[model samples]
Target: MTRSISLIPSGFPFLDKKWGGIYRGGSYLVIGPRKSGRTLLALQFASECAKSSEVCLYFTNMRPKDLMIQAASLNFDIQSYMNHNLLVVVRIASPSEIYDVPNPDDYLAEYLHDIVAVVNQYKPNRIVFDELTPYIGFRNIDYLNDVFLKTLEEVEDKNINSFFIIGEPATQKAQLIVDTLRHSVTGSILLKKKAEQLAGQFYGGTVIISPNVGHTEGQFTADYIIEPYKGISVEPTIMKTFTRNDSESEERLPELSKIFKPITKIKHENIDDMQMNFSNIYSIEDFHLIINNQIALFKSTGQEFHLVSLKLDSSAILKGLITLNQLKNSVGKSVQKKDKICIVENTILVLIAKTNAHLLNEIIKKIRINLPSRDEVYVKAVTEFIKIYTLEISNSFNNSAELIELILSEEATNAHLTLSELT
Candidate 1:
């Protein structure tokens, strides 16, 4: 007979929405490379589960001290859980100590047995195998598989949810082992470093629901970053577009209408005709054309142009657009006729002729000072919420598509996407 598994919130709206929370007695695989934020993701899951009064256990080969440090860095506060008796952390074996264990064959069996004993003693509601590969890597595949299967059976019998973190497999041998472990899990998520160049190292990957478990089976792509205090932040922009269906698409139309509704609802004489002038504004699509023209002009007359990106709150899109229009008016009054402005989605870009980063900053400062507080047009340089790119005509761009991707990637800035609270 099937039993109802208790569910725990995952703190991250994107994850909880996609995976339907961490279910008790469920096993999940989190696959990623070192520093790809997979560990942080697991810790976030474990912490949230513990917060809900579930007894959560963590088993890792990393030294307890080092694991604690890493957890602390990610704002996990694992120690607090220990204080409340909600968490039990087991340091299976340190990297250096694992190889030094005598009698490799017997050690594996006893080690697995010890972990099972601890689970029996505490009867945790959730469990995590942080870096499961190292524990079974040295043993014979057949022998280790048997032991692993036995361990899974014990956890399953207890109705305890589990998570296994596997390093990004590099070799055929490792891949084979990963496949073996994957077949046993209920669901899996993969995290990988994004190839796109940015100011800092950023990661993007996918979450796939196992066909054997969960309500969904398709793999959904997501972009995330590990923040100093905030931990993992998933981009809501991409997450909103991750899955599409007739029902979801139909629901989104009203939301879109709500944001743009003000454009027609609020009768402002100047704003009414703004839609007609959309053709005059250069779009992100026009990046290559504008850059090439600027380059030709620079080469002939020793002139320069720079691209400045301005973004507003994603959650406050309607308010932001109105603010953007106010900022646009401020910029229109200050900038020369030669300067070009564009609106792509919510962000605004200005192609300033005969300007450098320093001059652009000065102009931005004046715009901010001149902004009327009553208008609510808070416009600032692309330092955090957005990104700015300096374009040089001499710089080689293969095609317009490349330029578009670069500009759109500004959405992947370090700013975290906040979802409306899940009611």
Candidate 2:
């Protein structure tokens, strides 16, 4: 007698039709570089699996709160599933934390034990270990192979579909570990960033490697875009040509300018106070004037600016000008001299001039790390009281007024803008 295989849909109908979803009792690898949408794809899969009434476990190296916020920004209702006990998110220590330990191996062993305990307790139908890089970095090749094989066996025995995510290895030893582990997985998905000449935009592409699935005779590849209020969706217009020698092919698609209105120049008077005060935080009204002027400048020139919004919840203990000043001091250290800060009610806005996604991410990380802790009474970090959102304003906008209106709408709705949405 032969055992029947079970299939779990990836939530996206297109992916299900193309790849036939993921196989239960199988282990898969998801590899990607920074800024790729690998994490979003995995979250979408987990959400879909949970919707089908299957228990799913997600073990992540990021803070659970931060991960929840990211999911919310992508319109993934993971909290509902968690409420019903269909989804469980477990937080694991980051690589820096693991490396700081006196005995890294001992710390990893304890965490492994904890993971096994959680898996046994939940008996989840699906599991995702988002990032095995830290674990692989600490152990030798033989040890890594042993542990990874054991993990595969456990998942197979439990009949759980698992996804092991990792970034592109940086070191030779790390690459070796990834290579050894790749041979043991049932399938692998690779995500890459494709840069386009039109407005220097970046798009994500996915390559699926498996014996069971393909769009044509060779490897399966697809272009994807991340949209606001929606997750990842396939871009059908862009065609990817694979050569016989597997060399890069150049092909031009329809320009984005054809889809959106052409960029127009705007004229505005230079505000005297724009360069007057760098240390002082402005009011929301001043923020409007300054940001509008900056946008006008961006329209005339090709310079870009990033608008960052930090909102505090009503339940937060920290409030008033004191907290705002503390936040400004903390954030001021990380930003450049050209950047400006504003505060209104519970929202704080920062206008950063001339920056890209990677640098912006680093700035945000620095701000989060430098955020001050509250007094003994509150005994909480400032990050606990606030949420951050970023929007990159480029030459794609029709006018400054329209862009400002969108920002106002997003602030009113408490909706956060992500890098993928604007880029």
lDDT of each: 0.57, 0.60
**TM-score for all predictions?**
0.52, 0.55
Model 2 CA deviation exceeding 4 Å by range: 12-14, 95-110, 196-202, 211-218, 237-423
lDDT for 388 in candidate 2 is 71
lDDT, residue 41, candidate 1: 75
Question: Judged by lDDT, which candidate is best?
Answer: 2
Candidate 1 local distance difference test against the native? 0.57
Candidate 1 — worst ten consecutive residues by lDDT sum?
253-262
Q: What does candidate 1's lDDT look like per residue over 215-299, in tens digits?
A: 3533455666655435567765655333322243211000000110000011101111121233336665576687667766766
lDDT for each residue of candidate 2 in 1-423, tens digit (9 for 90 to 100): 555776668665545665576666877887776556667767876877787899888887655544654465355566667878888877665444564668665555444445556788778988887765555554556765776777778777878888887777655655665677777887666666556422123345554443322223333466776543355666656635343246654221111111111111111111111122456466667777887888888888978888877666554322311245455666776677678887666666788888888888888766655444322112232345566777788777755456556655655436763222322
Total backbone collisions for each predicted model: 1, 0
Off by over 4 Å in 1: 95-106, 195-211, 239-423
Q: Of the candidates shown, which would achieve the greatest TM-score relative to the real structure?
A: 2
The TM-score obtained by model 1 is: 0.52
